[model samples]
Target: MTIRLGLQIPNFSYGTGIAELFPTVIAQAREAEAAGFDSVFVMDHFYQLPMLGSPDQPMLEAYTALGALATATERVQLGTLVTGNTYRNPTLLAKSITTLDVISRGRAVLGIGTGWFELEHDQLGFEFGTFTDRFEKLDEALQIILPMLKGERPTFAGKHYRVREAMANPRFRDHIPLMIGGSGEKKTIPLAVRHFDHLNVIAGFDELAAKIDVVKARCDDLGRDPATLETSMLVTAMVDERATPDLIPSGMRQRMVVGSAESIAEQLQEKVFDAGVDGVIMNLPTSVQGYQPGQITALGAALKPLTAG
Candidate 1:
């Protein structure tokens, strides 16, 4: 089968009511399903980035929003792009995924990362530690969280977290796929090779290839089959009627897929063949005028023939 496709709904609406965003998210999920997209993901940020708007701008938490999404859509799989490991305790986070998995009928994949946003953690009163310290914590968190699904009461003590017989009750039906998100070669790729079911990198073909090579080598050294680990990318895309000179924004194309249907398809092919990516999660243009429903529909149409088995 061909690599699956996903979309990142960045939660970019102009409103305050929590219920208001549901319609947009539901619509996007439906669009993804209709377009034959395999999954739909949302950012786990507590606040909007400054470039997008205000730092204090409205945003939603990860689990609560995902719970609502679980009830809203039917076919499309859903989860966070990269949930911050420091946000919640590992057992609690695993339970949250368990609950969401049941609610969504086993359609949840856990995307996790070491996390980089200090401002959010500070503003929200979560401890912000050193880089190496965070990676250490992440490694420990994975060990604690992964076993909880197997009905194991985990006991782990590290420099950051010390857990004693943490119980995960009423486990979900399946082992929710764990996806590691980041491009760090030494630390992130090794962790992914050892623990995660998938790896998500935000880079072009060249960088993605290099990271994949690193992970593959690590997997080989660990006596693991590299094919067992899936690869995915997060891409910003602007889909208009046709390609134009100014269609793509500067300093963004390296991380984005822009232009006509043919151009976009070529990029997708490169990701699959060159970078060995198994899937892509496109971040569709949210703020651009006349791009929402129409462009989304067009993108779905363009990708239909390619995604069709």
Candidate 2:
């Protein structure tokens, strides 16, 4: 369930047409599998992130993409980097993930979070609730989803979601790994300690040490071992000749890695792994060399040894 090393395909606009888009994605996932990555993730979004590109840019639905990737790669665990809880019903969400587990032969990891993008909700006709409201929904949704994943039909009533004897069938595994992506101490970390097996910390690199400490403290508060709750952070990797440190976006400077594969690995070792986080999920959205045939392999070769344990 640990994500020591993972690849996240967060971009779809490759300047190559739609026909070539998925093939590039498949190639990257296969490369990741061949080069020792333990997991592969795709961003769960309907529109391109503002930082990456315009909203109109191509963004494949996460589950559909992962289901296809499951057949393409034999070993890599497949899941979304983080799924928005606002988009679907809890009962259906459980079914979708378990089905993916069956497709991937028990390789599905459910990475979910309180859906935040207001635009997606507004335009897609989903409810755009307040911050507190979203968290409440997430809490209730988990109540139904957890039991269903474990093969126990759960009957529950809550403010946001309720299901009576909800069941998921044709499951390949009794327990699929649960993950939530966020770094908030009060709500997210507590939920991670209570239910999630992994917490993908969404924080700046300079803040990682503190975030890990909070995760540990929350686990201790719940009388759970911090080691049991694995943690990872997404790093936008730009492995190319043009990977200048100054070229990084102001908001993303702390979270992105620039330069050669060796340098990128060294920076991660110093900036992220040394902070006590458990894993690194590298996202090569638009790195110049990243779309090339062998770049993912190069990065994996240079970085895998550090996280092999």
Candidate 3:
């Protein structure tokens, strides 16, 4: 259930020809595993995100890529940073992750969140609902997913979903850890305290401490130990010494860490870890263009110890 240091491959625009695209991804995943990363994640999106590039830019289906990743690497965990709950049926989503757990020999992590990204929904024919509608769907969907992940057959009917004795068979383990990604103190944090094993705090570096404190307060209100809920921050990372702060988009500047790998590690330890977040999941968006031979390995080496006890 731990995410000591995770690498997220958020883009697929490697300059290489199509033939070398996946090989390049495999190289990064292997580098992360070899450098002692605990997990690897991909964004669960149907199109390239606005922050990264145009809608038509290269993007891979999250589960398909994660399934392929399961076979390519042996040690590090595989998952989406957070699967959009509105993309698929709850029962089916449960089956998909359970199948991945079986394939990866129990390395699956069920990271999920309320669906966002309006364009994907509008273009893909999925319903584009209000934010509250999406969160309601997520809440009811988890009622089905959580029990099935634990090998139970759940039968329930809710406002947004209905399941009749839904089951996921051939599970690799009795439980597949559940992770929720968000920073909303009212909805997201309380939901995490109720159901999730991990919380991937999606907030700016300056706001991370406040979010962590909210998580702690939510746990306290529920009469639960704050330490029981693992916490991590999703940070935009720059590992190359040549990378300057100007390369970061102005809107994303507050969320990014730039410098040499060692200095980036120092910033994360001081800001994220010291703020009470248990770990970090970093996305090096620039690497989609190209990465040096040992760049990811070097970054992983510098950051893994920060998450270790």
Candidate 4:
């Protein structure tokens, strides 16, 4: 259930031919596992995000890819960084993740969030609702999902969904760790405090401390222990001596780390961990260009110790 150090594969545009794409992905996953990463993630999106590239860029379906990855590696927990609730029916999402858990032999993490990508909904024929509407949907979806994961058949009726004694069979474990990704104090943090096992804080490096404080306050108000709710941050990483600060897009510079492996580790310890986050999940978008054999291994070797309990 712990994600001490994780790698997120956000892009699949390797310059190689189509057959080499998945082999490259497997190599990266194996490298992460060997180098001490406890978990691996992929972005849950139907189309490529604008920040990363054009809409038509290659993007694999999250759970299907995770199922395939389960057979290719022996360790390293697998899941999406966060699943969008609007993309699928709650009962179906529950079934899919449980199936993944069975395939992976109990190494599944349910990372979920209220849907945010408008283009996906518009193009894919999903409802593109207002912020409050999405949150309501997410809150109701969890009501159905949590009970099913615990092997209970729940009958629920809400504004967005209704389920009559829905059950998720063939589950490898009774409890799959739940992770919520976002830093919205009013909605997301409060939801995490009440329901999730982990909170993946999405914020700039400068805003991390404040976000952690808000999480603590929310826990306090609920008469809950803040320490029980684990936390992590997502950062864009560049692990090369030749990488320079100017190469980063201006809008993303504050949320990105650029340097050699050792320097990146130092920055994480000082900036991310020092702000009270439990660990980090790094996304190396540059790897799609062509990753050197040992880049992930070197970064993992330097970073894992800092995240150890």
TM-score per candidate, chains pooled: 0.91, 0.97, 0.97, 0.98
For candidate 4, lDDT tens digit of each residue in 169-262? 9999999999999999999999999999999998999999999999999999999899889999988888888888888889987789888999
Ranking by TM-score: 4, 2, 3, 1
For residue 51, give model 1's deviation from the true position in Å.
Answer: 4.0
lDDT per residue as tens, model 3, 1-309: 788799999888878877888888888899889998899999999899887889998788988999999999999999998999999999999999999999999999999999899999999999979999999999999999989988999999999899899999989999898899999988999999999899998888889889988988899999989998999988888777888888887898767888899999998888888888899888786535574568788888888678776
Which lDDT values do the candidates have, in the order given? 0.76, 0.90, 0.89, 0.91
* Model 1 misplacement above 4 A: 1-3, 14-19, 242-246, 271-273, 304-309
Best by lDDT: 4
Displacement of the residue 197 alpha carbon in candidate 3, Å: 0.8
User: Which model is ahead, 3 or 4, in terms of TM-score?
Assistant: 4
Alpha-carbon lDDT of model 1:
0.76
**Cα-based lDDT at residue 139, candidate 2:** 90
Ordered list by lDDT, greatest first? 4, 2, 3, 1
95-147, model 1: which lDDT tens digit per residue?
99888888888888888987778888899998879888788888888889888
Q: Taking the candidates one at a time, how many backbone clashes does each contain?
A: 0, 0, 0, 0
How many angstroms is residue 224 displaced in model 3 relative to the true structure, after the best TM-score fit?
Answer: 1.0
Give the per-residue lDDT digits (tens) of candidate 2, residues 131-201.
89999998989999988999999999889887889999989988999999998888988999999899999
